[model samples]
Target chain A: SKSNEPPPAPPVVHYYMNNLTNTRTPIENSETVLILTPLAKFYQEYWDNLLKISYPHDLVSLGFIIPKTKEGNAAYSELQAQVTKTQSGPKTKRFASITILRQDTESPLQSQSEAERHKMENQKVRRAAMAKARNSLLFTTMGPTTSWVLWLDADIIEFPPTMIQDLAAYDVPIIAPNCFQRFYNEEEKKNDIRGYDFNNWIDSPTARDMASKMGKDDILLEGYAEMATYRSLMSKMYDPQADPGTKVKLDGVGGAALLVKAEVHRDGAMFPPFAFYHLIETEGFAKMANRLNWESFGLPNYLVYHYNE
Target chain B: SKSNEPPPAPPVVHYYMNNLTNTRTPIENSETVLILTPLAKFYQEYWDNLLKISYPHDLVSLGFIIPKTKEGNAAYSELQAQVTKTQSGPKTKRFASITILRQDTESPLQSQSEAERHKMENQKVRRAAMAKARNSLLFTTMGPTTSWVLWLDADIIEFPPTMIQDLAAYDVPIIAPNCFQRFYNEEEKKNDIRGYDFNNWIDSPTARDMASKMGKDDILLEGYAEMATYRSLMSKMYDPQADPGTKVKLDGVGGAALLVKAEVHRDGAMFPPFAFYHLIETEGFAKMANRLNWESFGLPNYLVYHYNE
Candidate 1:
């Protein structure tokens, strides 16, 4: 039988950053940080931050560009200029040099009719962009210097400097910081404010009796509390006697602000190839953890306000 | 490893005729036969036939009288008289003594109140009848008699007189004859002569395909041709890629006709308590045969028409 015991922690922290438009201010000790961006604007923003933070660390910023068509070559001339700008700078002697990487693009189908051709070309562009980000993350982590890889979404803004340290405190194989909906209150608070009079939705007397049996502590959070109340009032709900809880253990947690250990990636853990974007990574991570018998937990006490709007 | 080989055949055929009524019947000379009955009308009709058939067998007619309620003592006394009459008969002198049995009136509920109560009552009656017959058959076959036990439905009328000999020819542990619906090709011939397309009545195209695949040769009679076609079509519909040439084994044949070796009964091969009616009995028999890894097949060539109308 495989051991369910947790693995030991790694020594260093490695952050894997993906950029869409432009980067924010960078951290100190740049050698410890690896910034991966696609747009030229993002590279310029990082260059500004490099001057500002002035910390002694290695920095590798890979600027990815997809060629327009199969006939067109992926020109590194534009990326080479950005690389020259960073290396030839006054603080160049501090840490490792910044490298600009461009992903090669295959041509979209040219034979199809104009409408069909446009749609296919658009699809090819999106796939190439995704492939670039996934491959870059994989390649950087494959090196010996990397320990843990932190995935930061392209649009995140207000994250604390000690965010990495907070994640490290868990010492668990996989840790995810609580990414709260910035404007929304917790579920319990929302339920309290609603103050609905009627208890249960279903009118079964037996259900009403069961609902009376529930203690206040069992109410959980707001939306969940209402759901539990409704179920308690509905006698026709699934019998508690039938739920023998010895299966896969999971309460509930979302996959944003996730921090994964190096060993998980070394064991060939990968995101599932799904067409949909949001839940694909989350589900893949959960399934991988289950397969490897790794424990995963979310720290609700440590919340991150994601400023997407 | 358990033996997958079929059992060798017995030398003699054993027949158990269950008289499903209360009238006393004189039986003589037969090695062993159990006649089970509950009502009186059916008992009188088969008395003479029972006497003639029992000539080469040791026969025992078992009767059961059910009380109206737990408080009714008069009903119990009446049951005793009915059982005593058959046991004292002169014709039964050369055969095993007749026995009577009754279900406990005050037994606790063993089935669900809604659907299982009716089913449980029917099973109780049938099991009591079968158990008494099994005990008598075992007793007669033990002493100076080489016999096999055949279980026959009490309402069976169209059985051929040479049914025993036909069953005896099989060099297997059990023999089951092919059963057909009483009504034959009359409706089909009338429809065909009238130039009516009866095929339209079959709603599912798959069912029609199945009927055609089984073919006329595989079907014993014209009436059952549709059913054979349906079975063939249904199998294909479930798994289209499955091999068409492979023969699919059925769970159970209908219980209109059944024959078993006496030793099987003697060695405690009694019918399970669940099968009260023909459908249930057939299902139970099939399940038991499957558990023992015994081969059970319908004799396709010889068909018995069970007349219900």
Candidate 2:
């Protein structure tokens, strides 16, 4: 359980998103933005990170999905209070709109066989729920003017306030930045960085074979990396590569921080709440998008830092 | 698990809800009706019962809360097909709108101690999740014109199409119909009438004491009823009573066919996703409502029959 894992390393600035030299165009030509996040924890940090986004508040809409619990309720109420105060204040900074929704999370079971089955079901169902949630938020809020949708996780601790502008410069239908979490390497006696979000990766023959032997309810995701083989996560490939401008083709995308053209979703690309081609949820979403003619790519050198536990 | 309980007897029709004699009044004076159902099964029967409602097609909005799973996805898809088909077939057969949502169910554990703790968490978290899902739906969909909200389960099979009208006729702020499920007694070889939703009940001093003595994380809702006293489900009282027009005061309420005035929710009353005064979820909602000056009552004579499993 990485419960004894070292603390996060200091934040690093490794610029990599798109090579668009003209960052001004992104802000000027910015279409209506809908920022959607499904949150379970890290409330304070999540709100602070949100405020750091460089996008203009008037053109951006904020959507939060807080799962049901005492903690979640507290977060929702507190966020509401903060938003209300900000809206009524003299600075005149206000979002286009804000919507808060509620959901629930199940505690993971502890057992061998039963836990394995529970793990599979939990993974499948949780992703499906997230996909359903993302879809619900997207469809309900997407208006005629919405040009892009950005998916962000609540636990992202570090990103340039201009992260939105950087992704917008790429002009991709679906794209994700390299994700890394800084951790103190006790052996090295110093904080070191490691690629964390590996959900987006190139498939390999070994992975296909491993996935093939699984049962109807079984899945071969990143957590099973020890048993499965994959070519590389974009973050890993980006770290040692010479070319930072090139985008890596990906078969899947994570919600950690992703930018998508609103049309891809409007055209019926969605995260399947059930397994599709042995992939479920977000990965299933990547499959669904590819089937619907949307190409997905990742910026390996361009990075976002996930909050290390 | 009430697995060995006696069979439910023949269906009883106690005339209730708003008298349909002036059925047109219900349609004309319809308060933007929102029928909320949290579903995991009985897809076909649910849709059939939904379609059978005599309320004006244009005034009634259908909301189904589906928990995340492969099975739930199938049900969601099936219901979508049914809704689309019904919507496109005739203008007279359309609901005002239909919204389907997703949540997750917790897996029961295997060990004795862990299972007990899991049981406590399951009861608290599952009901809390329901409360959260219910609140999300209510807040998201409650329009300025919405005057009433009806809570129904998906498995209920027997009810007059004018059931909504009947419940609305009661014209109370919060009211619950008696719930009964039919079961076959193998020993008696005869079907018996039994009330199944004992979640709605009157609190007793004995049960309250037991609940208080228990840990904050512990509850004695349904399964623990055998071990704890102080609360008795209205279903138990209804079965033995012969009166035709009797109403019982309740400190708790279930979603199995309930009618609530919109103001109660608008005025800051909600289904507390956590325990309130030893009650959780829907019951907590009942307590919250009473605290807000809204009275809760259930008709012991007027009944709704659930499909026997």
Candidate 3:
């Protein structure tokens, strides 16, 4: 019986892996970075721009979350086709790995059409749902080897190819880029660019005065004429003649493109679904970080373009 | 003297390399592949599509040659910007290496305007210069470790991500894919697709008869009524219901997306800039391969899209 037994099996070897001891800052390519994107609509341009990133693929991980709805299902199918085509090839053609999730909790505004979803009446519920989605994707995909986390929006269609390296080079606890968009200029008869995200800004005396008068359950919004906060927005700070590395301190941040050190998130910085210091979502995350004694920053001259629609 | 002598230098290490003893058929990922592209005009779509390829980047080498002309110089500058953005980051963000050459010999028609470049009278001269460019790029970049060579065109905008693996799976000495383009259909009020490259085809009795009657200096042109070859073009063989792997024997080949075993080129197969058997350029290259007893094959159903302009 012993003589007739089969030989022992051979060991399998894996060639690609994140460094197990990677606990350093993510300024170097040796440290792994996690990119988290919350998807509502899957645009081909967004996928194309993602592929255009010049960061090393082996050092980056991707995570996505789609809401549970009819439109969400269609987006998932389209996303699957791209993922399969990208990951089914040789080891070098794929990212470190990809993780996708469906939201566990459904939003009350999930059934609203695109035209109605952006109304002022729906902003509170819509943003709360998005905050939960980001936390779900972040907590589920991040691991000990992940030294950095980048929150990239799915609708961002254009950015510099060296986005990750440029953002991480600052080595700040957290940083946000000035987001802008291109539009047709009827008066000039040509295309023109304008600031898009008003969420990133420095605190103003008028904003603090307004927050002091607001109720505990109230939420503050940026760029609203009805609620004049008079904050200096980072979007308005873009100077083409200035150095791209120009930096500024910020009390609020936007979700379009935010880079954070893994330690900041580990210390409990998160996008709060409820009103925190009269702010919610990305601004709430900034408030939480400040409460933990970690400062937020912005690159006024380093620009990223958002989808016009 | 002994006290003043410098200590012995430390040894260096290299992480990426082609298999040194690799002489097998190149159907496996372990073998190295060299991609050669002769550039006249630089199209961003072509570069983007090249990046979308799912093949292993570490196992592939890239070669390019730009002509010496105003248009060529502008294209080179545009290409260099993209290359620096891609290759200046981490090691994984770059190809194995890129070798770019400035074509030594200038073409007589290099100064022709875009409108006059494709006239019937200029076809022979234009294509001959293109052939020379291809030969220069190929011979310079391919080395002993290279197991395969892919001749790609700069204007080809789209193809399957698995193109390299799919074409190599056939293990044929030389193979090409059917090239098509998208055009506006005036009658249908919609975008329509049609074959673009008519070079890849099978020999016919009529074509052979015409070749026999041609002078040594005369060049035969395909898809031209004045010089009808009556060949069965691979472009005309596309069938929606047919399998993508369907293959057919080919007597002529196109340079848009051609794949060849390294041994074929090593054995003296090349694009003839002058008339050979009444054919020139890619068609002449196919004729040369036939003389060496190597058959050319085409994937009738596997299609690649080219830029219309």
Candidate 4:
């Protein structure tokens, strides 16, 4: 499809000054494409909190993946009951049908050689498994009318009633709220607030450099690169009581609490069941979203609290 | 192509944190795909300066587009001679075939209605035209072995002989050098160094918000949005005489000079002929590359300078 010839050179002039901004499009209310691919055991806490969200649930089309872990089938059975009880509403409600899927865990890992499995890092397998599970949740569950997808982890122990409304206020393509938990302070001897999750961070240049040297399956999970990474540059703000509006650029996203624009998935960004840019699962999705010019960020204030061991 | 069903619900947990870094695979002596599409009046300057590069010319597969403008045919004819003279080398060199192509410029503006043309912001048409021309250049000229494609505008008059090496040193997917010019003092001007390009920036939230609202044909060219943009955040380095190693993150790319890894192009990123997310042409290509997980940057110390009238 190319011309094979030595065409003559051209006389050139310096015509070079370029600038244009993208038009501003404002939306009063964007429909939710809520997706929950949780592997937690607390069905009641997750479901009850889902009802507590200040936003109208009728506008929300829900989906989740029942990963084929040991407790997966039992969790699916109970969740079905919960959905049946919760499904009925007035005629004005336009909620699309609910969706649920299961992991095809028929010894998929057996496909790998014994040697390969033995050498595989635990984190890598877990990431791949989770990524696969999340992929199942999205591809099998997403409805056409959805505009945004809020990813929620099952183990969230506490949160305000206004989380969905608060995160939507940022209005960026992808966003993660800080996940923290209260614990008996070993030092203070009292319950204290802590910014517990380290997954969402602003990476240092060294981490960026070290990334290329790692294997595709070797994901850069948080709490591991703390020495080299700034680990949530927003954390440097040093305020446990930070304002809700605060946000920062993110290198990775924790699955616990996230809000994603559905258009990202519609544009072909998915949780890679395998490594993508050395990241899998949620981080891989974040990478995929960033690559597509839909920027990702994390809120500094804790919008949702996670269960502590 | 996607499933739509309201299957049973699944219990989900906070299988929350995930991270992975892209591996940095270093390449040594990647082959060059040099391209320049010019209007042809400055043919002599373009040819001579090209011969001055330190990298082996024999290793380059040069290509260009001569539009159907007035001097376009004449420029193509002369470039054929220059290619012949400069093409000879030992067998060890890896030069691929040279290429030349043409643009259908017969009243390109004639297609636009007179009222529409009068109301049009010139940047929109320029960006669209340039994007189309560049796409044609790459689609028509690039060969299989090309690992890198260096886009050079005809107006660039000065650059390091090690220009390629310096840029490749960053080892990222996409990069651009700061373009500037030396202007003599008509009165108080003592050959002041003017940093010519302002498209590169660290985007603020307002600009990001404004992006989705803009039309596709609307291109943010340099100098036009100095007030709205965080213009050339790298230009604050305050180095009229800084070293070449200095660099910074870029939000937009200037057309005067740019270096791109070919795989980014091969992976479906190109100068989008139509508007893509409020950007078209070079900036759109940068956006596309970034979406595919390639980081783009700019060198602050002027690696190249453009010619003035």
Which candidate's TM-score is highest?
2
Write the residue-wise lDDT of candidate 1 on B94-189 in tens digits: 335332222222233333232343353344444333333332223322211224445554334444555655655553555665443343357575
Off by over 4 Å in 1: A1-309, B1-48, B59-95, B105-146, B179-255, B266-268, B273-280, B300-309
lDDT of each: 0.35, 0.64, 0.74, 0.59
DockQ of each: 0.01, 0.02, 0.01, 0.02
Alpha carbon deviation, residue B211, candidate 1 (Å): 23
lDDT of 4: 0.59
Question: Candidates ranked by TM-score, best first?
Answer: 2, 3, 4, 1
Q: Rank the candidates by lDDT, best first.
A: 3, 2, 4, 1
C-alpha TM-scores of all predictions: 0.28, 0.48, 0.47, 0.45
Show the lowest summed lDDT stretch of 10 residues, model 3 chain A. Answer: A9-18
Better of 3 and 4 by TM-score: 3
**For model 2 chain A, the run of ten residues with the poorest summed lDDT:** A9-18
**Can you give the lDDT of residue B170 in candidate 2?**
64
Q: Every model's Cα RMSD, please?
A: 30.8, 19.6, 28.5, 18.6
| Higher-scoring candidate on lDDT, 1 or 2 | 2
Error of 1 at A52 (Å): 99
Error of 4 at B161 (Å): 61
Any runs in candidate 2 off by more than 4 Å, and if so which? A1-309, B1-26, B104-122, B223-226, B239-243
lDDT of 2 at A51: 74
Which portions of model 3 show Cα errors greater than 4 Å? A1-309, B1-29, B111-115
Q: How close is chain A of candidate 3 to the true chain A, as a TM-score?
A: 0.89
Give the interface RMSD values of the models in order: 38.6, 25.1, 28.1, 20.6
lDDT of 2 at A56: 85
